[model samples]
Target: MANTVNIKIDGIDVSVEAGKTVLDAAKKLNIHIPTLCYHEDLCVAGNCRVCVVEQEGVNNLVASCAIPAQKGMVIHTNSHKVRNARRHVVELLLSEHNADCTKCYKNTKCELQDLASEMVINEHMFMDLVPDKNYTTDKQSPSIIKDDSKCIRCQRCVRTCHDLQHVSALGVAYKGDHMKISTFFEHPMYEVVCTNCGQCVNRCPTGALIEKNYLDEVWDAIYDEDKHVIVQTAPATRIALGEDLGMESGSIVTGKMAASLRRLGFDSVLDTDFSADLTIMEEGTELLTRLKKALVDKDTSVKLPMFTSCSPGWVKFLEHTYPDYLDNLSTCKSPQQMFGALAKTYYAEKKGLDPDKIVCVSIMPCTAKKFEANRPEMRDSGYQDVDMGLTTRELAVMIKQAGIDFQELPDEKFDSLMGESSGAAVIFGATGGVMEAALRTAYEIVTGREVPFKNLNITAVRGMEGVREANIKLENVLPAWSFLEGVELKTAVAHGLTNAHQIMEAIHKGEANYHFVEVMGCPGGCIGGGGQPIPTTPEIRRKRAEAIYREDEGMAVRKSHENPEVQQIYREFLGEPLSDKSHWLLHTHYVKRKRV
Candidate 1:
C-alpha cells in the first residue's frame, strides 16, 4: 500500500500522497485555490501568497502550494483570516502592477487578472506604487517583448529560463524594493545569449513577456491589392489552433485551419509539411552520405552524430553555447524556412508572379521562427523569403478579426504543388518525429524495403521522454549499399534545451556514440513550442501529440520519399536531393556566436 497522509480540508477528510502539497490535496476534492506564480510545469514558488489557507494550531496562514500535506492536519481554505490574507496579497501585487488590462496583451488570459476577478477585487486599497510611465520595455529581441512595468515578479519566467531550459538568460538583478528580473548587466535582450525560445513568455503570468506579434503587418499585406499574399501553416499549428477558438484541446482542425486561412484572404494556402518532407530527403541523404563516407571510404573528417537543424531555437542554442559542434549540425534549413524559400522561388515562378510582389507569411507554433525569418542569411531568394511569421495565437486573433467561425468552417484542401505532404511530415510536430521519419526513408533506401513496423509507426521514437534512443540494424541491403549489410544505425532524439544540453554533453565527452541526433527546442517538440497555446501542461501536450499521430496514420503517403509533390519539385526544378539548385534554395549554414 502507498504511504498516504490523512488531512481534513474544510472539514472533509481526504487521503493524499505523503509528499504531496496541501494545494495538491485540495485539488483532489475540487477545492478552489487561486495562484499566480504556481505552474504545473515549474517548481513550486510561494512568492505569491494567493494560495494561503488557514491551518489549525498554526500561528500564521500557510502557503498551501509550498507546504506539505501532513497527517491529521486540519485546513480551512475559505476561513475569514485566509480570505483576507489572500485578498491583501493580491491587492499589494495589483498596487505595483500596471492595471491597464484593456491595453495588456494578456488581458483575458492573464492569470493575475483572472485571480483578481476571482477574488472580487474591484478597487485597489493601497497607494499605487507603479511609476507613471517610467518602465522599461525591452523590444530588442525579434521574437519576444519584455515590459518590466507590467511584471508581477512571480519568478515563473526565471525558473523556466534557468531550470527548464538551462538557459539562464534571465535572473534576479537588484535586491529588495528595486529587485526585478534582468539579463546580464542589464544588456538588451538581443545582445545577450537568449535563444528567443519564448518559454519565458509562455510561463509569464502577465503582459511582461509576450511574442512580438506580426498581426498588423500581416493584416496590411492581406488588405493590399498589389501584394500577392500566401500563407503556409506548420504541422503543430493545425492541432493547437482550435484551442484559441473555443475548441477542446487536441482538436484536429487541419481542414478548418486551411479553410480559415483562405477565408482570411491569402492568395494561396500551403502546408509546411511539404517542406518537412523535403527536410527528411535532404537531411536523410546527408546522413547517408556521412555514414557512407565514414564506413565505406573511412573518412575521419566527417562529423558523426549529425544533428537536425529543423528547430531554429536549438540552432541558436548551439550557436551560442556549443560553437565547436557547429559542423555536426545538418545544413538543411527548417521546414518553415524551406517553405519560404520555395514559395518565393518555385511557387512564384510556376504562377509567373514576381517574387517581390509575393508576400510569404508563415503560421508557426514557435516564436523563434519570427527571429529565424529575419536572419540576414534567410534572404536567399533575392528577397526576404518569409515576409511575416505569426504565432498560433496571432493566427487565431487574425481569424477572429476576420470574423471567421473557425470551428464551423468547411473542410478545405491546400493549393497544389507545394501543398501536398506525407504522414512523415505531419509527425514533425512531436519530439523524435524527425528521427523516426529519417529512419523510415533511410532504412528503405538502403535495403529497398519498407521499415518493418506495423502501420509504419516507429513507436521506438514516439513518446514524451526528454531524451530517447533507437538503433536500426540494416539487413538485406541493396547492391548499391552492400557494405557487408550488418551495420546498426544508431540515433537519438532530445527535446527541450536542457535535454539537448545533456545529449550534447554526452556526445562531447564521448560517452554516447550515435550516427544521428534530433533536437527540438521546446518540450514535447513543436506540439509544446514556445508559441503554442497557453496553459500548456503535460496533459494538453499529450493530447496534441495524439492528434498529430492520428493525422499521420490517416494519410495515404506515410513516408517522406513517397510524397508525389516532393518528387515533382525535384523533377521540375530542384533536380534531386542535395542538388546544386536544392542546396542554393533549400539549405543554409549557421554561424558561431559568443555566449554572453
Candidate 2:
C-alpha cells in the first residue's frame, strides 16, 4: 500500500496520498483555493501567487499549489496574512488590466472577474502601473482574434498552446512589465504558424482571445418575418450546449434543446445526426470505391491512407501544415454541408418549398465551422447549402431572449427523416468517432462479415491523448490469403492542430505507415471546442466525454453502418455510394489557399 500523509486544515483531519499538494488535499475536504496560474493539465507555474496559504512553522504564507503536503502539517487556508497577500495579487493584476468589465465580453463570466468578486477586492489599491504596450490586436487570423490589452499575463494561454497543444504559437516576450503575449517576432497570428485551432481561446481566462461572434447576423435573420428559417444541430451540440445555459458539463439536453429551438420560433428543428448517418452511407461507399480503385487499378493518387474531412479545422490545418497530403483527404463534404445540400434539394422537393426562400441555419460547437460555411465549394444544391452557422453559446443566448424556461420545457423530438439517428450517428460529437464509424462500415462491406466486437467503442482511440493507434486483421476473408496478406489495416487518431503537426511530420518522414488517420482541430474534439461554453477546462471536457459515452451506451444502434435511417436514405434517393448523384451532391473537392 502507498504511504498516506495526515494533515489538518481548520480543525478537520485529512489523510491524503503522499506528495499530493495542499491545494489538492484542500479540494478533497471541500475547501476552495483561489488560483490563476495553476491549470489542472499544464505544469504548475506558481507565477501569479494568488493561492498563498498560511501553514504552521512557516515564516510566511507559501504557494499551496507548488508546496507538497508533509506528515502532520497544519494549514490555515483563509488566514489574514493569506487573504492580504491574495488581495495584493489581485490588486496588482487589476493595476495593469483593463478594468472595463461592463463593456467587456467576459463581464459576467471571466475567471478574473469571478476571482475579484470572490476575494472582495473592489479596486486596485496600489498605484496604477500602465506598462508600455506594443501588441494589441490579432485580427489577421480568420478563425481567432487576439487582444493583448485584456491579457493578465497569467500565461495560461501560453501553457495551453505550448504544453497541451504542442503548438507554441504564443510566448511571453521581453521581461517584467514589458512582458507581452505575441506571435513569432510580433507578427500577425495568420502570418505566423498559428493553426487557428482555438485551443488558446478555450484556455484564456479572460476575453483576450475569443471566437468571432456572429450572433447579430443570426438574430437579424430570426427577426425578419419574411424569411423562413430552418435550423439543424450537430450531434455534438446536444452534449456541450448545456454548459452555455449554466448546466453541468456533459448534460444530454437533446430533448430540451429541440423544445427550446421551437420556442425560438424556428420553422423546423432538424438533426445533423440525421445527415451524419447520411454521410456514413455516402462516405462508406466512397471509401470502398477508393480502395477498389487503388488496389485493383493501382491508383496511387487517390489510394491508401484516406483521411477524414469532417472537421473543418483539420481541413484547414492540412491546407496550411500538410498540403502534400491533400489527396489523402476524403472528397466527401462534412455532415453539416451534406445536410444543407440535401435540405435545399430533396427536402425542398418533398415539402414543395422553394430552396431560395428557405434559410438553412446550423448550431455548431466550433469556430472553424464559420470558415467552412463560407467556402465557395460548399454551394452544391444550386444555392448556399447553409446560410448561417451559430455557436453553442450563441444558441443559448437566443433561447434566453425568446423567454423559454429550459428546465421546465417538455422533451421533444426532431423533424421526421432528417431528425432520426442512431448511436453511431451520435458518436460524431466525440474524438475519433468519425473514424470508428467509418471503420465499422468499411470492415463489414469489404469482408462481408459482422464485426467481432458488436460494440465498436475502440477505447484505444478515444479520450484526450495526443495520439492513438489501432490495428485489425482480415483473417475472416479469403482463408487462402493469410491475415497479413494483401491488406493490413492500421489507423491513428489525433485531436488538436499541434498533434496534427507531429503526425504530419511523421508521415512526411516516412515514420508512420497507416492506412487511415482521423484528425480533429480542437484539443478534445467537438466537446471541447472553440465555440463551446466559456471557461472550458480539462475536468469539464472529461465530464462531457463521459456524457457522450453515456449517450452512445443508451443508443439503440451504436454502429453507423447499422443506422436504418441512413440505409433507407441511400436506398430511396441515391442509387448507391459514389454514384453520379451522390458524387455531385454528397461529395466535395478541396482547394489550396495562397499564403499571402
Candidate 3:
C-alpha cells in the first residue's frame, strides 16, 4: 500500500514499507531480536540495548527499534557478537535486579526471567549488587505499590504514565547506575497527581509496580463460617480471568468463572451487569430531566457535558487532574459500587440476612475499583458497601489456591434480585458502554417509542480507539423551554487518560464541545485495567473486549430500561427514576483532592 524498501537480514532479502523500523522488518522476516524496553504501544527507547543488530558497512551494532530500515541494508540479527552483547545486557540487569524469584511475587511469569531463559543465561557471573534499601517505597497509594528494588530503570512505566495515561506521577531520577524511578520530591504515589489507573503497573516489565491486593481480607472472610461471603463479578472479569487459568486470552468463561467462585466457598454469586442496568434506568432519566430543563433554560444547575461515572479511574482523574470540571461528572456510582451497595442493602433485606454479617466482595478487572470501594462517598448503604475488592488476576489465583478444576466447572447464573441484567448492562465492561447504555434508555423516553436499534449496541463507539464521536437524533418529546430545532446530540468517547486529557483540554479551550462524554482511564476500558492479568497487550486486550460484546449479543434483553428486575426495583422500592429516595440511596457527591 506504500513505498517499499528491500533489506537483507542474515542473507535473507525482505521487502518492507518505508518508515518501518528495523524491529518491524526483522519481526516480519521471523528474525529473532531480543527487546526488553521496546514495546509496540510506547515510544522507542533504546536505553536497553538488547535489540542491537549488526549491519554491513556500519560503524558498529545499531538498535533495531530506533533505527529505520534502508534500501538493500544488510542486517545481521543472529551474529555471535550480537548474542554476546544481549547476554551481557541481561546479566548486568540481573546483577542489579533482585534475583530472589522464588520469594518474589512475579516468580515464574516475569519478563526479565523469560528474557534470561531465552538467552540461555543460567546465572549472573558478576558480583551481586544489593539495591538501595533506603530508596522510598510509595505505599501511600491505595491502589498501587512501587518497589524500587525490582525496577530495572527501563523507563517503560515512566513513558506509559506520561505518554499513554497523561499522568506523569513517576519519572527517572538521578543519573547513570545510581539512577532510580521516583515521584515528585520522592513523595508517595497517592500524594502526587497519580490517578491510580494502574497503566504503569500494566506496562512494567517486572513487579516494580503492583496492585495493593485485598486477597487476604477475602480469604479471612471466606474462612469465617458466620459471615455470608458473596461475590459479584464485573463484566470484564470473565474474559481476562481466563488467562490465569491457562485458557485462551479472549475466552468467555462466564459459567466456568461462576462455578469456580461458588466452589471457593462463596454463599452466592452475583453480577455487576445487574447494577449496570439500574444505572441506565436512573442515568437515562437524569439525562432526560436535564435536557428538559436545558431546553427551557440554557443555564441549568444540573450542568452540561455530563461525563460517564462507570470508570472509577476516570472519576479520580477528574477529581485530581481536572478539578475545575468536577461538576461535569455524573452523580452515578460505577456499577461495581452500585452492585455492592445493593448487595448489602436490597439483597440482604430480601434474603432476611443482616447487612453487617454479609460480606459483599467484587471481582473486577480494575485496580481503581479497590480505591473506589474505599471512597468515603461510596458507602451510601450506611455500612461499607463493598468489604473487599479483588482483581480478575487475584480471583484466578484464589481459584488455583483452592485447587478447583476451573475447566470442568459447569456454567451457572447469578443470584436473583441483584443478578438480572441485559446486553446493555454487560457492555459496561468496555469503553463507552455506559454512554451507549444511558443513550438507549434516554432515547426511548424522549421519543416515547422503542429504540430503532433494539440491539442498542452502537458499534461506532466501541473498541480501543482513543476517541470516537457519534450523533443521535431524538424524536417526539415535549420541550420544557425554548430550544433550537434540528439539533443533534454530539457525544465523544475517550478510552485512555492520554486521550481524556486531550478531550478535556479541547473542551476547556472551546476547541470542541459535546453534550455527553465518556472517559475510561485505562486503555480498552476495564479489560486492559491495571489490575487485570499480567502481560496485557493490545492483542490480548482486544480478545477480552470481544468476549464482553459476545456476552451482550447472547443476552435476552439488551436495554437497561427493559430489565425486569430493574423495573421491579422501581416498582417496589423507588417510585420512579431520580426520585428523592433513589437519590438518597444511589447518588453521591465528589470531593476535590489536592493535586500536589
Candidate 4:
C-alpha cells in the first residue's frame, strides 16, 4: 500500500497520494484552480504564479502546482489572499502582454484569457508594458510563427523542446525583465535546428507560437474558377477534427469531415489514407528487399532496421541531430506527399484535366506537413505537388466560415479512385500503427497467411509507451525466400523525439538490434500531433487511440495489401511496388543538415 496524505482544502478534508501536489489533490475534489504554465504533458513550471493558493500558517501564498501535499495541511484555493495574488499575477501578465485578443490566433483558447475571464478582471491595474511595435516576429519557418511580444515567459516552450523532444532549439536568453525565449543567438526558427514540430505551440498557453495557416491561399484556390481544387484528408484528421468543431474528443467524424469539405466547395474530396495504404506496399516491399539481400545474398551494404519516414518532423530531426544514420531512414515519401504526387499525375490523367489546373490541398494533424509539402524534392509531378497544407484547426475555421453546421452535416463518403483505404491505414494515426500495418502485409507475403492475431489487431505494438519492442519468428516461408526460413524479425516503435533519441543511441552502441523501426515525432503519434486540437492530455490521447483502433476493428478490410484501390493503382499505373516509375514518383532521399 502507498502512503496517503490527508489534507483540507477550503474546509473539506481529502486524501491523496503522499507525493501528490496540491493542484492534483484539488482536482480530485472537483475544485477548479486556473493554471497557465501547467500542462499535463509537460513538467511542473511554477513561473506563471497563477495557480498560487494560500496555505494556513505559511508566510506567502504557495504555488500549488510546484508544492507537495502534506498530512493535516489546510489550504485555501480561493481565499481573499489567494484571489488577490492571482489577480495581481494576471494583471501583470496582461500589462506586459500584447492584449489584442480578437486578432490573436489563440483568442478564446488562451489559458491566460480564460483565467482573466474567470477572475472577473474588468480592468488592468498596471500600465501597458508591451515592447515596441518594431519587436520582431519570426515567420521564416514554413510551419510555425513566433511573436515575442505575446510571450508570457512561462518557459513551457523551452521545457517542451529541451525535455520532451531532447531537441533544445529553444531556451531562455536573458535574466529578470530582459528574459525571453529564443533560438540559438535569436536566429530565424527555420535557420536553426528546429524540427518544426508544433509540440511547443500546442503547450504554449498564448499566441506566442502558432501554426502558419494557409487558409487564405486555400480560399483563393476555391474561388478561382480556372483552378480545380481538391483536398485530401489525413487519417488522423478524421478522428480529431471533431474536437475543434465542438464535438467530443476523439470522435470519428470521417463522413462528416468529407461532407464539410465538399460544402467548402472543393472540386473533389480524396483521402490521404488511400496513399497510406500505398505507402505500406512500397515501404513493406523495401523492407523485405533489404532483408532478403542481407540474409540471402549476405550483402553487408544493405541497411537493416530501416526507420519509417512518414513523419516530416522525425525526418528533419534525423537530418539535423543524427545525420550519420540518414541511410537507415526509409526512402519512401510520406502518405501526404505520395497523394500529392499521384493527384497531379495519375488522378489528373484519369480525369482528363491538366495537372497545372489542379490545386492539391492536404488536411493534416501535423504542422510539419506544411514544411514537408514545400520541399524542393516534392515537385515530382512537374508543378508543386501539394499546393497547400491545412492543420485541423484551419479546416474547422473553414467549416465555420462557410456557415455550414458541422455537427449537422450529413455523413458523406470520399470520392472514388483515391478515397478508399483499409483498417491498417486508419490505425496509422496512433503510435506503433506503421509497424503493425507493415507486419500485417509483410508476414502475409512471406508466409502466405494472415497475421495470427485475432481480428488482425497487433496488440503488442499498440499503446502509449514511449518506446516498444516486439519480435516475431517467421515460419513456413515460401521457396523464393528460403534463407533458412526461421529468421526472427525484430521490430521497434518509438513516439516522441526523446524516446527516438534513446533508440538511436542504443543502435549506435550495438545494444539493440532490430530489422525494422517506426518513429513518430509527436507523442502518441498523429493523434497527439503538434497541429491536433489543443488541451491534449494523456487521457485524451488514450481516448483518441482507442477510437482509432475501434475504427480499424470495425473495417471490413483490415490489411493494406487487401485494399482494392491500392492494388488497382499498381496494376493500372505504377506497374509494381519499388518499380522504376514508382521510385521516381514515390521515393526521395534526404540531405544532412548542420546541427547548431
lDDT tens digits by residue: candidate 4, 373-426: 999999999889999999998999899889988998899999999999999999
Q: Write the per-residue lDDT of candidate 1 for residues 525-562, one digit (tens) a residue.
A: 99999898897899999999999999999999999999
| Better structure of 1 and 2 per lDDT | 1
Local accuracy of candidate 3 as per-residue lDDT tens digits, 404-439: 988878898777887888988878888878778777
Error of 4 at 408 (Å): 1.3
RMSD in angstroms between candidate 3 and the native structure over all alpha carbons = 2.0
Query: Candidate 3 overall Cα lDDT vs. reference?
Result: 0.83
Candidate 2 vs. truth: CA RMSD? 3.2
Error of 2 at 423 (Å): 1.5
Can you write out model 2's per-residue Cα lDDT over 1-596, one digit (the tens) per residue? 35888999877999889989999999999999998888886788888899989999989888999988898889999988888889988888888787778977667878888989987776569776555455377776656778887888889888887876666778889897788887778888766656566777777888888776767777777788877778999888898888777788878999999999988888878999988877777777776677667766677777557788888878876776567778888888999999999889878877778888788989988877877777889898999999887788778888877877787778899977677887777878888787777777777766766556746676777787888898877665644223324477788998877788788889889899887888887878888777788777778888888888788889888776677766776778877777788888988887664332
Q: lDDT of all the models against the reference?
A: 0.92, 0.80, 0.83, 0.93
Error of 2 at 385 (Å): 3.1
TM-score of each: 0.99, 0.90, 0.96, 0.99
In model 3, residue pairs whose N, Cα or C atoms come closer than 3 Å (at least 3 residues apart or on different chains), thus clashing, are 255-411, 296-481
Off by over 4 Å in 1: none
Please give the range of 10 consecutive residues that has the lowest summed lDDT in model 3.
477-486
Report clashes for each candidate as comma-separated counts: 0, 0, 2, 0
- Runs of candidate 3 with Cα error greater than 4 angstroms are 131-133, 297-299, 478-487
TM-score result, candidate 2:
0.90
